[model samples]
Target: MSPSTLQAPEIAMRPALRFITCGSVDDGKSTLIGRLLYERQLILDDQLSALERDSRRHGTAGEGVDFSLLLDGLEAEREQGITIDVAYRYFATARRSFIVADTPGHEQYTRNMVTGASNADLAVLLVDARKGLLDQTRRHAIIAAMLGIRHMVLAVNKIDLVDFDRAVFERIVAAFNDFAATLGFRTITAIPLSARFGDNVAERSQRTPWYAGPPLIDLLEQIDVEDDRSGKPFRMPVQWVNRPDASFRGFCGTIVSGAVKAGDEIVVLPSGRVTTVKEVLAPGADGKAETGDSVTLTLTEETDVARGDMLAAPRARPQVADQFAAHIVWMSPEALLPGRSYLMKVNHNSVLATVTDLKHRVDIQTLARLAAKTLSLNEVGVCNLSVARPIAVDAYADNRDTGGFVLIDRYSNETVAAGMIDFALRRATNIHRHAYTVNKAFRTALMHHKPAVLWFTGLPGSGKSTIANLVESGLHARGAHTMLLDGDNVRHGLNNDLGFTEADRVENIRRVAEVAKLMTEAGLIVLCSFISPFAAERRLAREMVQTGEFIEIFVDTPLEMCIVRDPKGLYRRALAGEIANFTGIGQPYERPEVPELHLLTPDRDPAQLAQDVIDELIRMKIL
Candidate 1:
């Protein structure tokens, strides 16, 4: 149906199908998309004119039109002439609607392909009839299968170039069908077509008179996708608040799956609070809504609901847990190791999660998953996740909205993977019991102010203390209760026993972070100036605070500058072997790659830097 036809009343409509094109770089994936769009007449007049202009501009290379150029928009992509990231395109046909994701073809960019096909309902795995089943196609199909996309259409593209030979097409089709069936992709549709010549895209080709089947578009439109979101309870993760009126705030987000009616008993996840829907609202006077509709929902009671929380029918509420096993596809260059915490984005909620164990590495070729110690980039494995807090979710097969998540490296902030949750935690691996003592409010009552921690980290003589002292004085003058934890001061008491060794350094940061955490709980702004040199340590310290508490000020003065401004002659003595294990002299300090505040030495003025930090805090509503 045309998009305009979707506006018709009293007609039961089929939902749009989301699919991805997977093949080698020159396997005609892009050409297939362009052909599909062309036959559907989706291209605007001006757009076609622009395409002609670009064709003339580029002098027209290759066997046919450079259809790959249609999706490669990045300058680097156009220059290197390869798709890197996943590119999404939307178009509708007279029979059905389509959402296509174009993925990269490079072997190294297999991670990109997994990301593209993760949310797809079907995958159009293209193959060059001339070059039957390449390793790249096999790799992509394995990932798609692992990610739970069952339906695949084997588009044997570029058959026209092969003289439209029936024997050739049949041989390639049989080989791929056998491979796909072996890989557990049962519903494989092997279609013969030439994407460049627009044969069998929207219309059945007359070239192969022997094969009698529906056109590709007919199969796409006829395929049932209602079951994708059907037979499940209502689930809509609150994405934003629509405050059309100050008196009321309506929860707004796309209905991920299932149906909801007015007065449906809804349960807010991770909280177990129950409430009935007061109204299921759309702009129009609608009776009900299915999946993919953006609507506002008002509850009976004014319960505190925000982004990163799921709203579901009370009868089918998802399971809550702090640990779960997932089939994780590693997407980063770094290896997944034990004791490293990853930032997990489960549904809309973000949590600090660590892996309990690396179960096995999935052998894509042999289909035998082997027990392994680690997973590298583009590798698939089953691993267990342990979150810092309890999260409500469901099995991926039952509910994709609640079951999928991206794992981010806590230290590097790089998204390491796309994970499909298997089931709820079999054994409770709780990070901590849900307990709120000395809450943010209670801390404010005792301290008589709002709590914040000025986390200063730098080399030994890089002016961290100088800047922190000036900032503390400024905050004190402003009637904000502030405490400055200088490394010198801490060495006299709490961290006195600690030393310059790696273990002692880690312990020092931990102690300081805990103190800062406690001070934040009491609603006091504390300034901490220490040589907390490690990125991992600093990130862990930041994660300790709930919000508006930890402020990292990186005194990024150069080592040479620190040595020159060594007020205590520590740098001079360290060079002369008097001061042992001194930072910037003997000990290594990992610079703050992304510091909240970057400040130079005292000669550049510390008071101004402190004021800048204060201003930033106020602007972020953390003051």
Candidate 2:
């Protein structure tokens, strides 16, 4: 063969490495990524020219092109000279491809950083050579480890500014190693580089003669990115059920772990139904279905299959339970309220769930477990979660796809927290609902009236208790069986341990709601009077009873008017800072958008308001 026509030996391409850049703000993360892209010839000529021009106009670097400008695409980010969101960039070398995520470093934007690290296989943590390690460095390390990133590279950037001192670099490495030892990373490679000058990033630098290691790009190109899932037991969460016609019925989803072939015996989870795989139709594949393959599966016999169900190897099925222990990272500005119902979405399955207990909050700085009743924004905690129905799940260490979940606020539809399953609680599987012969209908018929809950909600001094007492008196005189659950009275007994914090308030309402529900089952009209400030908790209470069995009575007294009345001198104490987290003072009271009865307390007498509630109940035929 002619020399020009000679074919070179084929070299196996390396698997793409997914990594993220993180650390304290202005630690040269963006510049490092920009320099790496430039050295790899990823930036086009016109882009380079624009970058140079912009660098001269608004860059921090005096003469050189501001490489950070390439990645900080947001105008706000450019103006503030900080990364505000996760910026993903793609590039390639001759040996391998790479997906790099540049994450924010500010504590306020920790949620954004989590988004970047969720899918990464490795992390490149940048540190200013002058500022060895900051609090943000520890936080980023903790988050990266929580997300299951096992490998890390501590890039001490701006070494040139530190005069390439070997001692300085050694101190940084030692400090980081001391901290990282607790994080459980398998490998931590520390390298000194000046990203501004492109030194030791893509090529070796003579200035760092004392340090001998491969360049950053070289290390990334050679590191193994392969994670073998073929040896694991088969697991595929059904994302969609495809039934186009009578002849075709298939379960479709991407296999998350292991492999499956035709005639393999599989078990559907949470159902325990066993069947043989009739055929595996993996589109664009030769045959069979492997991990990461999106395929349609056919069963040998007709079975009850549905979306959100799991298909797994019969011998290694996941745990099916209604409750589990999990590690959660609360991401919402509103603190996490225990006992409040939220929408928990895991894979394709979404369930009504409640954070049953706040075990403890993790201190990112010291990794200490501190007792906490609530979790604020960016706080990590261990908690118990109870779902409305049992779900098939694996520990996060075993399967990220089936064990990770997000809690969404049902009313706002906002993601408030992310959680990883640890294990199913033993009690969750042991407990079963006991069926009784005498039910709500039977009790209600005997009482000659429908069982119902009249929920009174408003500000603390909005006459909720006054109106509720009057209504209860009227019901008792009319021979209607009734029970009253005033918030303060219940607090002195059932919820005395609870406080006024949002979390405690939620638990308090939950207890009262359960009590009211039980009372209603005995055919008594249960009356609840409390400043149930949050609408979500009120909605939860309403859902416990049957339709029209729960009535929301809003005592719409203005805050100024409540403060003027100060029924129990609470507003005075709250205003004087004697009490913290008091409703309508330190804490917020969410006004009911729509209530069954909205009584403007200041405009009417207590008797009139109570009569309105009784009249409404009579009109609804609940009396």
Candidate 3:
């Protein structure tokens, strides 16, 4: 068969491939992409002339045009000769079409690479033949695997510099294969090439005749790029409520996965409202809708459906929950504040959300899970998130659209993190709040006094527990039901598993505040004494209780005084470097700025402070 006739069969059988190129800096990624475009005749004559002019002025190719200039369009990139952002390019050959993303190779810009690779079908990892696989190469490969790129092409670039030795190519391939096995990649292809000289990219290289493999272009053209969602259950997130007229209503969005047709049984998630598909309207299409189609769907019966609501097949409905365990990539310059509220955008839905716990941060080099309190820029961590309301979501491995989300700063509107849901916490769906007939109101009426929680916070050795004990004693003497929760005593039983790290401290305060809330709801006065160094965690505790029922009491004792009065010898241990993460020493204490009551403990006796608290409670009508 003639070459043209042979190419016709391959052209009719292949689909467009979307892939990304990434590795360490100066690995010839830009040059490889530019060479592919040039070979395909995608550049215009005017563009070629400008490229030649630019090459003459500032070129690294000596006498030839510097192909790297074609993709590095940013001023900073040109000046520094490094990629800083993801650059997307489109081109086609006689056999196949391609969409390629040129991603950054620097460690600080790893987040940009993640953004580009999120939608790619494959990855082309470039490696310097002289340096083999560097740390950045391993990082990119791991990230690509995490983003679900199963197909990889390890292009051993700059082969010309290494004299195109077949043994050198084999050694690099062996090492990469050993490491790639641990990543669970389905397919890995290694090729010997020189992107600068255009060898083994579009054409076979004569220098590496000892190595036998197809060129890079042939491998991309013949690879299967079919997705597995074609036969899965249908899912669509409502993007907008289409109300063209008083009589017409529809839900408009793109079908992210699976297939749907008219008369299919569907349910609106989190609401659990059942409905049938009345009509499926696609742009100039028949009566069916499939994945990637943007259409308007009308239900058989009128139901209250709005933006962020998910429509899914009733038999394969998604999990509805307000809490989830997720993997997050921190993108903002500011570190992730554990208890601070941020706006979470999942598909078309937005909700107020908080990172409730930081499970662990992944070490990109060693792939180890390290305990962490906060995630910094370009860091990856596992965390638990709590949303204001329940949302219909799937595990990210099952469906990317419904399981991926971004956290935006509420004040600045800047995107702070990118997250992928692993799964909903079991308690979120398994446990339900059961209401009892005898409630807080009946308990308060029986006690003949309003229930209240007095939270005492200060530095260590600040006389908080001493004052709290005396106040509880006074309340008991007056025939009032009361309980006192001292930090040390509770830590010995309830929070025995917790430590002194910031993350553990947050959990400790959270558990204690919850117990106190329950006690107050039982119609008893509750006193909580703890250092509670972080203001954010303290605020979270206050939010768990009823408005006006939580009263903050600040024990204003100077740090120097607490150190001098070191009752537990904790300060001495901290000063001697025998203890770590001690509040007032290694960690910081965020003092309450506007407590309901402030007591100066410098010259006051414990009984006097206790009497003052009782008098204040009486004035507030709590007695």
Candidate 4:
């Protein structure tokens, strides 16, 4: 039986179907939205008047009601005649309620679609019948799949422009299905419609006698949506700390998953600290509330917890890690390269981070794997990340709530990229069964002392290797086990196969960082002197070891001093057009925005600088 046929008559407070619409500017998205709202009688008279006023404001068509003007908000967005931010609308019929997200329709704004569809249970991808299956369609579909949106409805809009030709609709559906088959989405309900003419939008159309199916709205009302949160694990990310009084402390947030009750055992993440729920709070109710309800929860323990911490069932807790692997989408005009740090925001929480390594770039057009050194604008790639602080996270597949993160420029606060967590590096494991017996103490004994790494990052010929060797000899005389990875010595042998390109520079630093990490793990004081040049690479090397185990000592030698100290004369040749990728002479070097320690040259003696580095290490208590 049809669901509406036997349903009790009542108002729907919340939408049963959550969907978003994405298409190019000329695809008539706003017209379709207007049609849905108008037919459902959800449009307020004031809203219609506002749209009319806006229509005349933009010198729109008279009386006919400018449907496009309905969605055009913001002067800049309307001036450009495109959607900017994701606009949400709500409406309902006698049966199921509808929540629609109208997202921007530009190739560069692919990241916005991800944000819109991340929470959507269904996605309605409208395609211009005249312009059959475009790249935007594929891009939107893949994003919906990536965000775990399974249900899909391909609305073949603008059928009136196509002369109601059945072949045109079939051809478009065939093309989309041909490509979409490769991905994980199979439940697609394609329909023909003309939002401008109001055909096949609310009811079955008489225009297309050959096509017999329920209208777009009817299909939406009838389609089954499983929001059964009863069986799923409970998750509540504390978004607000509500301390109504000093005596009452309540953690407030929306329940994204299963139900929780008073006195239930819950664990706060990244800490593994367990506690009991003292109060299951509704805004003002004591009764049980299911998922999708915003409420304040008070735990039994009077322990201190604040925003960015999550309350979930202890058994299904998320991983706590300071570093992780993720699939990142580069959205900024500036390409994403290693050796640069970014701020990562996961869910409601944010942290500082760096793209340590780019694994492989995914070809959106062909779905082929392309080996890339850096991520260009609007590119998707797998990469490793080292965060400044620990984040409580889960795999994108397991839980979208904690799996996704956004990369922001640390200085500017501009959101540069969006990332999906693949796995955590220092992921919390079964402490009961697993053991980390090889701690820092075990490594220190084997190396005859403690494990330490000297990370030197600066412009080329900054006397990094010269000072490193001198320090290594001094430390050796004191019977300190040490290894010196000079830039010239290692490049000639260990990294001889690598080049001096931007991609090669990242790879060189990555290999060196890994070697230093291994050396520290093996309990040796390793002096890694390289013109790594990028602050991000230096930070990654530091993150690999425990606090104080890795030290960043910047060789503060001027470019002119480096040119004079160039034993290979490479810098001089670079200035004379003999070399192309020489740092400080030909290529640009990003000065260390923040360094742990700085050593000056041509001003301070080499011995003083070396001793200064040693003194800092001893003070840090890592010696």
Candidate 5:
């Protein structure tokens, strides 16, 4: 039914409840939601007719109107008889209105479920009575809790399959309750129902006369999960700076928490510039706006406020820092490795962030803390991150809107993980960069030459180190200060702790880049030779130095050629199953899209390729 038609005088003032239904595959989440809407007479007549027709073609029920067809609307979902994405439906009762999201139950779609649960205040977790508390059922519940859902409904669905036995219902509820106790849910209500037959959904079931709890609809209507954010600290992220004419300048955004009024003192965050709210403009508002209200407010003065900045109560400002600890839910197929840079979008700001450390990963089955170097798909980990700049944030426990963030792959632009900030690291505020007077300019003047890092990257046995060494020897002969950092030589000293794993390879390149940056500052020509398989790390190394200070030299040797000319015999061992994560043999190598110099090494000698590198550096004016 339309909410306007069913709106009662007393219920008109009630806030809408947003919830999600999720569990393992084929646990009847869609069917339960469809039955609830159908029982309330919310479906239109034409929709009901379509459901009847579609039921015959794709129905799991035997010659009955398949209620699941209402929510499983996708063509793929209908063909497979399962939910692949989240489906949202709006409906109303005489007592309340609701927005319910039916999230997919498949394990591969766990990321989809996280998206659905991020905004829900309550989670109605379904479980097949016959198969009590499966792995995915626990996974969804844990994810719901991690996303700040405190209220839950443990709907023991398909009870008819287990004959509605009281013992069966109690056992399932007991197991869930035992596991959920550690999840920190505020309220968990257990109910037994048969969603297919519409028993104990909108009304109590006659078959299960032993159960005494209220029906699903009644429980949802009565459950109090309201979060009065208007009473908390005021926080509004600036989405736009509106200036239609010279006479007006306004900041426009939705108030994420607390309330605001004209003349209220506010501070622009990460800058801490204080100003007074001159006026509040909101449609149908009375000079005030609270949480969830999108409004524009003019400042008393021309303060430096821009998009991605936040306005907050002056005395209760959010934390501003560049380093923090957080819980991340890895979403991409590629594993999350430490030291790899990603773009993190928190609220309205996008910043370059790197996972500094992966403290521990949560064991999905046992929820135990285990030391881990990286996080795979659908895994949860506690990690430390360092952002490119300081950002205003609150702890996730204090304010979810400002504290939660998503990591986007810098190269692919794919969302790789969702993270919730725990707290800022104390060292972030304590450590400060000390300025030095004798800078790179002074060193360059004394040395009579510009400093640059010539980076050599290629497959193993591709003559990267030999070419780098030759170039450094030529520079040294020309009375230029030079240092050659070969991959094997540095691994034996500076990067001895690292191995051939992807995570270790990333760190190895990161450390070498920092060293190269330092050498450039000292006005010394630096030659770095490494098998930097990942393009992202090459980009990272390039960004570390000043413009025109980093030159990428790609020794383009075919993999087969490298395998045949393996002077170190590493490729043979790798192909013989003795070496793991060996680039070009076991681990995949991501070639550079565009390098400053691509010296094909198959037909040319190493000395000629080294001369090609020297010629390119001279052409780029780095020599």
Candidate 6:
């Protein structure tokens, strides 16, 4: 059934509590959740019989049924006896319904933990009673807090291993409280329990006579973490344009905050087009929709609204800008470097974005801000970002649905980082583009030729620069205004600050692309001779210019031949470990999947190869 058609009255009166269990490896997070299900009699008779058989083969509990088997359903997870992904289960009691996420504890799966915690209202952090506290325990707590989970429950599992010592439990609680003082959690409840033995899980156990607090399940049933999104300003991210036929048009999405009804004034964000709702189509008889309701609404006037556009109350609008600052959790094994382009996905909108600067990295150990140039895997940092176009957003503290985003690697399509928006940069609002009468067309007319960039790429000693020099000479002799940007020559001036690292190479290509773009505006035939290895950056360069204005010419030369020719001795140095991250030697070179021109230089002369590039440009009508 559609969510809009569901019985909303029951959900509104008593919503299910969403929570996650996270901690270091072997802290019994999955076992804790499984025990809750078992003790509450939520497991079926057949599943219990299967569990008993599987426990004998894969269970770590030795003689008894491994409760963790209930959640660790993956074959790989069962074989490895570890949680590698988030596992979710649903259960209910007379007091409440609950959805619990069992998140992995390994450092490599931190991204999985972040995904599970993103929508959770509370985090049930389990810790081994004998171990006290560990790095990953602290890391998970910090990430949960950053993702806007305001309530925390410290589940000190395996109290039976330590003979249910009250002092050990109190010491762990005190240490966590000290670190959590600045995390902004509204409540912190610590409980001692043995998930394997069912002590203090569903019901209070007499094992710890000194303990007076309620059991873990009772505390979860009574804790209140609702934020009352229905009482806030109306906001809905348009997920689709519902149009069955030409006779009707409607915007469809679930309301994330506040309420909307017929005749209510709404604004489409980023475009700021104002319109009134003509009709609301929902399950409710009143024709009104509030938070968590998926409905369709027709506008009174036709506005330029599309998917990714937000419908919001006119009086309380979200910030719209191309630049912002955010806290990021770097998830990829490849480090995040400033100035490299990435794809940012916020809501349904995807835009090209770059981390302009790494403001600082947060030390999980000390919570100190340390200066950093890059963020390694699992590192948390604050960064300033710039996007290709403006997007609507809200501060994460105000609205998570509109404020959270993920950065994706353009080539791999892997999610590299998760971010929480803080605010738009002041400079983004101040900077403005000035209009001019003399533009690219006027300059093209004055120069008497069309502008284009011939990007020559290949191995270092691939004769790219030698042929580019010849091409520029021919164009200049023909009175076609031209410029040559050799890779080595550029590093002496425009890219002097850059090194040979992968990150530096990405930034190097980015600056050269921008310069080439400006030179194209002046109606000059720009020749860029660089061994741009990564295909993503080369693609970025092509996209920066107008269609048909960028031509990629691949200089095909064998690696053995280049090593033998070694004009600059770069290959020898790279092979001897004198240089690092050198393309074709220390690092990988992603060959162009397709190119406009391919020149075989082993048998052909430099003059003939340069002629090939010129002929291709002529065929493109640039000559």
Maximum-TM-score candidate: 5
Backbone clashes per model, in order?
5, 0, 0, 0, 1, 0
Better of 2 and 6 by lDDT: 6
- Tens-digit lDDT string for candidate 4 (13-130): 3347888887665576777888888777777899888877776766234556666667667677667667777788887788778788888778777777777887788888899999
Cα TM-score of candidate 6: 0.96
* lDDT (C-alpha, whole model) for all candidates: 0.78, 0.91, 0.89, 0.79, 0.91, 0.92
Tens digit per residue, CA lDDT, model 5, 124-228: 999999999998998898889888899999999999999889999999999898888888899999999999998899999999999999999999887888786
TM-score of candidate 5 against the unseen true structure = 0.98
The segments of candidate 6 whose C-alpha lies over 4 angstroms from its true place after superposition are 1-14
RMSD value for candidate 1: 8.8
Q: lDDT rank, highest first?
A: 6, 5, 2, 3, 4, 1
Compute the lDDT of residue 606 as modeled in candidate 5: 89
Per-candidate TM-scores read 0.68, 0.96, 0.83, 0.78, 0.98, 0.96
* Clash number for candidate 4: 0
**Cα deviation of 213 in candidate 5 (Å)?**
0.7
Candidate 6: which pairs clash?
Answer: none
For 193-241, candidate 6 gives per-residue lDDT tens digits of 9999999999999999888999999898888888978898999999999
- Cα deviation at 565, candidate 2, in Å, is 2.3
In candidate 2, list every pair of residues with a backbone clash: none
RMSD per model, one decimal: 8.8, 2.1, 4.4, 5.3, 2.0, 3.6
lDDT of 1 by residue, 93-113 (tens): 655678999998887788789
- Cα lDDT of model 4 overall? 0.79
